[model samples]
Target: QKEVEQDPGPLSVPEGAIVSLNCTYSNSAFQYFMWYRQYSRKGPELLMYTYSSGNKEDGRFTAQVDKSSKYISLFIRDSQPSDSATYLCAMSEASWGKLQFGAGTQVVVTP
Candidate 1:
């Protein structure tokens, strides 16, 4: 188990909405954020990445990066059942640095 607790999930959401997903860690040295979504047996696909601190948005997805708080978040808007997957959070010292994973969160977007 990790101190990384994802809220409103291992989650279930209706086809088009959900609260933000959060992740917290103890490593203050981490400087990069990576979010990935993996389907039942498929390889994980990278969703987004953020540097030290700030928010980044791509389409309906938003990533909030706060290094000072040792926190990061991924928000999915207008979710679809296809959004249902095992989501993974990773942190690194640099963009290509060694990756450390969070405990992982699974989300279900219901139809």
Candidate 2:
């Protein structure tokens, strides 16, 4: 299996829907969990970062990590067309920097 796996989704939903994106990783050595949002042709922007397992929330986004299951998730609340983008899950050993990423999930929020 690949080190990380995520459905490269073109998951389409109407405005105001809640969106959930997830990934699974095979490496237990990964110490940092992260989510990134990327627009077409743009570098990803960091969405969230968590160490080990637990939950972290910010504005419209929430990130969850389950180390026992080797899984992680990102939830978007009150989704909007402006939120259309690719969501990427990443993990790394260093808390200060760099990440290994999933292929990314593409999302479209329509009016």
Candidate 3:
């Protein structure tokens, strides 16, 4: 099985909708959980990052990690058309650098 699994969703929603994206992992050694947003033709940018298990929120983005369940989630509140992009979930055993990423969920927010 893949170390990390995420629904490669071409998830579509209207503007102002709350979107939820998730990922599950098989590795218990992972210590860092991250969510990255990538626009077309651009590199992924870090949206959220957490160590071990906890919740982190910034603006309309929230990230949660459950080490015991080996799951992680990202929630976007009031999603906008500008938010349309591919969301990637990542995890790593180290502090930084290398990380295993999910297949990525494509989200399109329409007006």
Candidate 4:
């Protein structure tokens, strides 16, 4: 089984809503973390990156990591239809290709 477990949510929300996403991992060796957003038929683009147990915010997006609990989360404020995408949580013990990925959660923000 994969080291990470995440709900593959087809989470639907209205415009200007807040979008919440999370993931859990079995590996404590995971020191690096990232969140990727993938649009339909497109590659995932880096959305957030955090290395420690804390929260990081960039604009309307926030990423939180709790290493003690082996959990991580992402929040998107003021959701928009353009924000509709698949969110994949990624991690690595070292860096680069060692990344482990979670089953992406599908999100839809309706107008």
Ranked by TM-score, the better of candidates 3 and 4 is: 3
Each model's TM-score?
Answer: 0.89, 0.95, 0.96, 0.96
CA RMSD per model (angstroms): 2.1, 1.1, 0.9, 1.0
Clashes of each: 0, 0, 0, 0
lDDT of 1 at 95: 74
lDDT, residue 44, candidate 4? 95
Regions more than 4 Å wrong, model 2: 96-98
lDDT (10s digit) by residue, model 2, range 1-111: 789999998999999999999999998888899899999999999999899999999999999999999999999999999999999999987787578889999999999
Q: Per-residue lDDT for 1-111 in model 3, tens only?
A: 999999998999999999999999998999988899999999999999899898999999999998999999999999999999999999899996589999999999999
Q: Which 10 consecutive positions of candidate 1 have the poorest summed lDDT?
A: 1-10
Compose the digit string of candidate 1's lDDT tens values, residues 30-74. 888889888888998999988889999999899999888888999
**Model 3 RMSD to the real structure?**
0.9
Find the 10 residues in a row with the least total lDDT in model 4: 92-101
What Cα-based lDDT does every candidate model obtain?
0.83, 0.93, 0.95, 0.94
State how far residue 88 of model 4 sits from its true place (Å). Answer: 0.4
Candidate 4: segments with Cα more than 4 A from true spot: none
lDDT value for candidate 4?
0.94
> Residue 54, candidate 3: how far off, in angstroms?
1.2
